[model samples]
Target: MQVLLRGDWRQRLRLISGLILFAFATTHFLNHALALFDLQAMYEVQQWRWIVTRSWPGTIILAAALVTHIVLALDKLSDRATLRLPAWEFIQLALGLAIPFLLLPHIVNTRFARDIFGVNDTYLYELARLWPDSAVLQSTLLLLVWIHGCMGIHFWLRLYAPYRKFQPLLLLIAIAIPIAALGGFMVGGRAVAQMIADPKTFDEVKQLSHWPSPDNADRLAAMRLIVRLVFAAMLTAALGLLVWPAIQRRYWPHFIINYVGAGSANCTFGPTLLEISRMNGIPHASVCGGRARCSTCRVRVEEGIDAVPPATFPEAVTLASIGAPQNVRLACQVRPRGPMTVTRLLRPSTASPADVDEAERGSEGIEKPLAAFVLDLRDFTRLSQKKMPHDIVFMLNEVFAAAGSAIAVHDGWIDKFIGDGLLAVFGEKHGIEIGCRQALRAARDIDLALDHINAKMEAEFGRPLRVGIGIEAGPLLMGRIGYGPNVDMTVIGSAVNVASRLEAVAKEKGAQVVISHEVARLAGWTPAPELLSKVDIRGVSEPLEIVAIPRGRDLPASLLASIEDVDERVVGRAAF
Candidate 1:
């Protein structure tokens, strides 16, 4: 219900009508392709096609869909704040608008002639009339309709992952259907031309079609001309809307949209902030175009925020989902009703596949119970003080790689690499109990992996590298957070802070690993009573009871022996 409410009703209506028209076009193309088999086969399919399309209900439905689509298209055009559009969007629009003009003639000749003049419009009769002379026009019409419908379908489905995964297959089908239809059309036309060369066959086709009187034929031709002129006028009127925004900005009441740190755009009342940005060539990010389905186009109104109207239901829902402040609004959805200063929330360069995930993932930004693991390199300042910047970076990379592999072996997600340490979360899919167990196992593995690194680097550093590992389990809000390209999956909760504090405690006590009591209990591990101790942690009201291990190599061999090998797929999937 919420999803439906967030949808633009006009867009939904347009898609429905477009799909209906595309279905009609598909059936027509398939019927035409039947001509490859034989004219009799084409006739048989055409008859079945007409039984649905020529029926009273089908005719009414098709006509209603056509009118609805046209009216909504022109209405949307009239509402545009600028003529600027993405390349594919412009191409699709141009193709769609050109289709009606090309299609008018075809309809007037066949369906209109048959309905009004009682003309028997069959493949034999129409092919005889249109064979070689009007071949170019017919072929162009076929391509235009098919291309327009395919573009619409493409735009509609491209947001889905499944469509993108199978796009190559779909593209091949899109290409093959048109080629087959054109081949059938050309073959059938050639056959008609050969038969019509015989004067007897030509006369028979004309008589069989119940050739209309000269007066009725003239009337049909005149009506066709009149229909073409009217359609041309409508299209011209629609195109004329492009100039209205410029005219309004010059003479009508407008607003100055000040984009802090960039510039300002003088826009009329109708244009969205995003449209104004594009019109004036200001860079802004909008991964989902202006559909209000993604939050990338959001802007913070720094000044005169109260002057901006409230966000609509869809816009409000998106902002709320992202936990955006009250002053922020989607640049695409909000049309400035008054002068206001705004700041774009995202950089255009930050647009990426992650934005698509944000749009499609229903559980994005939700909270779940999980394990937070924090690790810190021991004596990191002393180790790096004597080394070159490049040398220090290389050493840190080696340490991170060892730690990262251990986390991965246990199905943990490496959230981010801190300067000398890292944060890893576990059990996004398997639950917190599994997560706690995985995180504890990963802690011991990290220590063991670093031992190998230490053996290699001991001669150069004069000492082995050491790290402090901390693990805590609790409910945490895990999701992507940060500005633009810096956005990353991270967890936030008391458990995260407690885990970090435990890492510090491990370094101070010279212990290889430290974990809150909750982690051990959740993982079902029973350490020695001597290793169990309590330490005061900042922000934690009570002293946290924890298990401290003096050496990672002595972290209970039974724990490792009892556990199964970690599933490779469990690692690096999500921040728990």
Candidate 2:
């Protein structure tokens, strides 16, 4: 345990160093935001900021954090065998690598120059030097650093209970602060440009910067040389990590990763699959950037699960919460110690095989035909207007209880409740035929359940409760929608919409249960020829044909055999 913690010290140090730097950067950006108010206010605030930051203890802490962060980052780059990263992580990495190059010049001219030459720095002096090209560089630098910091913080707190609730507010601040800073700088620069245009103000600014000194010119030249040398040295060190490992590959061992479902074999010398996937252009999802915060990138090891180390605390907690089997592991957190075959499990509940393949690039949902069942309690509105709120709520609870149970029994899900109505979907797992059949059975069962409920509640209500059930089975979209707080897993498309319209049609025509012709045909329930009727529906171009079934009991076995006979004749397959 001690050895494990010791080896993890580098990662811990990097996080702490990053947070300290982020704190400093945040304060600096906030100071820049003040420029939107008044340039003098910006300058005035800067004094107190500098007073705190430039103090002996502050200087030591800042310098130490900077060196530790840079050194540890370089070590990670060297240690890593693959360069695969999620889009945001890649962006953050690129920006982090660019920071020193953008920052060195500014740092040397101000922090170093102030210490060495006793230069009096002010807003006017900064404005003259930084306006135009330098302004763009500074703004880019600020944003890069800020974004990197924000990503780090997000990765750290993403799994925490409280952070998830307040994330929107954090996101708002993260976005608004940088924009305000950039705007503030532009406004301040405009004022400074006006100052420089006046000959008197220009001279004073130049004097403050100690310009025209052969000594100052030499110092500026020396600063540029130092920045170049530092950047080159860092680059060389990073490249060496990659080069040295490759040169020794023949002498060292390797690991083979067999993707059980992706239909491809891949090899990597590295430990982490998350990095290997990113580096190799394999489509994978890692919401927490490999920190094991969220389990969206989890995989089930088919073989050699024991070859990797046991789950760490974070991984264990996350896996247990989801009731993942012993074989399941987070791809980001697990780095195989030996060859392993694994399958990714972070897919939508209803995702098809094809959808899973495409979703590696992110969530591209599956489009399929499904049975959409829309059930609306007839005259619910009239009943609601007359009943007390509590009484109506009790009535609604009973309705949901009956409808929801029937949906579950038929292998369907209650999509949502609409006042006294409920929307359910079948074919989530089974194909369209069985889905439609299940819908028909569920509708019948719901009617029977409602009859039972009304029997017990006849004294409470003067009339029996009635419901209209509409069903349509056809091609539609099924997948998880949204990200962050807005995310949902459900089906969406024309079939769902048409099913909803059909429910209204049922209410309009005074039918207890109505199935679109498509569904009736699909479910193999060809009601007597005369039972089929026509009704106009919105979004559908022509008058829609439907079947009005009369029973509130099990669909006859003859219906299943008839449907199979039709399919065997047409598609040559008995589906149900």
Candidate 3:
């Protein structure tokens, strides 16, 4: 009983309800587009109205489904509010809530009036009466409906692979359809007004066309046939798309059971887990409609771990980064080939412990000496602009991989990648001296990696890649900020700013690697007599002692000469 309400059931309910609402909106909009065919398509409109609004069972179901959907949405929104979502998310929710409020009058006037009061007005009569006095209200309602529906569809497609592929095209069509429909309404309304004002000239001008009349028997029959065929085709396609995946599982047989515990149930497996949980009733969290993207439906495999297949790449990456235990897995991502006992790890009020720990750590901190390394790839923007997007991505992957490998090999934590630059922190978990040594080793390794990359690029693209690196050791404060899921783990202090300035100086001096005297002292490395120089860095009250590092034994003798010229130029600039 706990298993059913725990995760999968909630997600499935949200997905089914969302899709039903989407289908309802689509059909309703398409029906409005009928105005494009004729100014007085009252017969077709009336037929739709009778079938959907007049039938007792259909009306009841529509009301019930809408009420349920709204209630569920409000519940979800309240949960998100507790998490303190961004301003944009809140704005979107506000707009979505406004939709039903704006729509209530139209629904009550048209459907409720006809069903409860037996005021079976023609489509033209209803449109004419509603358009003049309620134009502003009607326009506002239409805009709200279209925006809310599109936002829902956008979020839904983002979770599904098939829909994701056609997102751009779907967005274009979604935007254009509403424009075309609104334009047709305006044109059709004007045409109808002209016909009513001068009925003598317009021979076909008629009042209150009724559906299922003897005069329109053939048209009504054709309309019913088309509607039925369309509904059948949609139903068939939807079923095939959804059900076929499960049926194919018979041969491929990918079944996974996850256990989520609220203290009492002994971990169990199989279809019975879902069935029993639903029968007994238990509360679970599955906010993303059971899609694998939302990891809310996660469980910890407590026993029979070998029964589950290995985690997929995305699942593994997400889990490992968040430092989840080996047994922890998203229920939607895992599929069991055999029986497995699982325990639910999360509750409505709590997230993963590791995530909570990181969030807490990010907020509390103090200034301490840390080693910083910065690397900037020269002329990368121009290089990227010349290459195709796919090729550019390949190049960037290679570059980042090489740089990251160097940093990791020297025991540094990659702080962040800034476009074509790399920033890393050394000895984050160790003392300042060790951190300085690690940063220096990382710089040497990066030079070696760059040489290899340049050689390969020269051989392949007939061009070399150049980069500048800088290392510094100083005191800095590191912490985390931001709200909810969007928190940033960040470092702050004069040390960071100084490290960046040194990197900029490396570029100006045309040197491969530069180190501040502070870093050299911290690492217990004596500055080479010929390589030492003093320069006034921007924003610093005192001039800093700097050293330029040469690449390997193959260093050009003229490198020292170039450094001398740069030093003289800096002095000249300072004098001026």
Candidate 4:
């Protein structure tokens, strides 16, 4: 119970209550849709619906959910450090806030009058009062409520991959339900209007409706006004809560923040660096908002690191996972305590929610063992000098496309394309052992793809294209780097550097692929002694042991076959 009062519990409560309210609204819309068959069909469905909805249990649950949802929304609004939000979020918020205001009169007339004034408030009574007169207002309310519910559902469900698969069908259903209900409502209203035009039918419906006397109707009107006034006061109080802090904090102690390269801004102590950036129009990358999930908003504290408090629990976990230096901090988590000088690690650009992947969420800010695959096209400068610029671009595109396809097939992420070279990372999801084998397989696939491409391109170009492939595995920090459209999720470590060096070595030795001894050991492969060699690598103190494959296709099949054998052995032991 105490846990429910703190941290993310409020968000959970809001979602659950909103879902209950949405369910109620859906059933109501479905009941309205039955009016297409005729007023009798609508009447029959409403009777059954009222049996459940008008019961004490249903009424209490619905009333509780509605009150809770609204209160939570207002509380969230009051906690906002800045009104700066993504466009979709802003639209959803606006629509949500508008719903209660538009819905109040209808609720007061129907439910309040039915309960307190002994009015029947049946379909006939509602249609006679609403048709053609309140039609537009009612339709507006229906659309707003439906749209707001769908947006909330979409934002929440999109976090799960399964929901994304059925989003198109779900969206179609969302659209069709409201439209059909609206059509039925209009059709039913017209039918009621025709009936009311006849004096005989009008007399029957009026008696059956059990409408209140004129004096009672006047009393109901005054009650509705009172209810509206009370609601207005509550709304005003919520807005005051939102605004009072901003006004009071204007006089709070301010701190100056100096961002290297970018300009500086002065702000009060409460808002985070990322919020301060947005408030001041400074470009900052925060792909996951300020949730401390994505580390895109990390900055190196160049000065005043000592004055700033250490990272909180969540921030510490994210920073440690990403192998962030002691001086580095997430801009979203760090509140400026005093004057500080910091450098933004990621450039600012427009980043959408799509930029974050749910499956890869856990790996975002982490150090893990990953295999690096670096491939460089050989003699590309000479080829470019011989060919026209367009021809060069076309040729490079084909090569890159083939290489990218091959890497993807083996579960590798193409980190970046460097002129004529490329870098890929493996083992983010799987362990390093499987990742090493996958890298070797990807290197072989790339070789085969290039062979096929050369067969067709040899007629246009003078000769076949050649590439040097290198594979290495070690603990590496993987993260999203750069800013704007140029951003890439890449790996950075000495292992990547060594992989590039091995690619150069492959070119120097005139071999197709060069892999470190570590790769062979991890992948469960034992190369012939004669095939192994020790070579000095640049920026390294000791000579490295490696294997140079003359042809990628020549890699022993046993390297992959061993994995099945190991799995079988484990299963066998478990069975005993």
On lDDT, the candidate that comes out on top is 4
Query: Model 2: number of clashes?
Result: 3
Residue-wise C-alpha lDDT for candidate 2, range 447-520, written one tens digit per residue: 88987899986568778888888899887776546432233456788888888888887777777777888887
The TM-score, computed over Cα atoms with residue i paired to residue i, of candidate 1 is: 0.71
TM-score (C-alpha) between model 3 and the true structure: 0.41
List runs of model 1 lying over 4 Å from the truth. 2-9, 36-39, 126-136, 157-176, 190-197, 210-224, 252-255, 260-262, 312-325, 346-366, 371-473, 479-490, 494-576
Assess candidate 1 and give its lDDT. 0.80
For model 3, state the Cα shift of residue 538 in Å: 40
**The best candidate in terms of TM-score:** 4
lDDT of 3 at 391: 78
Q: Which stretches of candidate 3 lie over 4 Å from their true place?
A: 1-11, 40-57, 77-83, 197-323, 326-576
All candidates: TM-score: 0.71, 0.59, 0.41, 0.75
Model 1, 1-576: lDDT tens digits are 233234478877887899999999988888788888888999998999899999999999898888889878887777777768776678888888888877876788888889988889998878887888988888998998899899878765655556778889999999988888888888899999999899998888888986667998898788878877987777778767866666767887877888876778877777888898889998887765677767777777889886778888778887776677788788889888889988776665535435555533422466789899999988889988888899888889899988898898887888878889898999875788778888877888887888789888988887899899888989899765664334445678988889899999998888988998888887767888999999999999988899998877777664563344333323534434
lDDT (0 to 1) per candidate: 0.80, 0.74, 0.60, 0.81
- Candidate 4 Cα outliers beyond 4 Å, as residue runs: 1-12, 33-52, 122-132, 157-180, 183-199, 211-253, 269-272, 287-337, 342-367, 386-398, 433-466, 474-498, 505-576
When sorted by TM-score, best at the front, the candidate numbers are: 4, 1, 2, 3
Weakest 10 consecutive residues of candidate 3 by summed lDDT = 78-87
Candidate 3 residue-wise lDDT, 1-576, digit = tens = 111122244454655666666666666665566677875563486477568755887667667766666656555543220222334345556676666655655665555444444445565655554555676677677667777777765654454446657878998989877776676556656665665566553323333322123434344345445644554454445445545544553465444343434433322233223222332344333433333444444566777678667876655644554456677676545645466666644443433322333332323455667888888877778787767888777777778888899788766878788888878888676568667766776676677787777776756545788778877788877764433223345676667677788788877777777888888776656766887888787778999899877652223333223323535654787899
Better of 1 and 2 by TM-score: 1
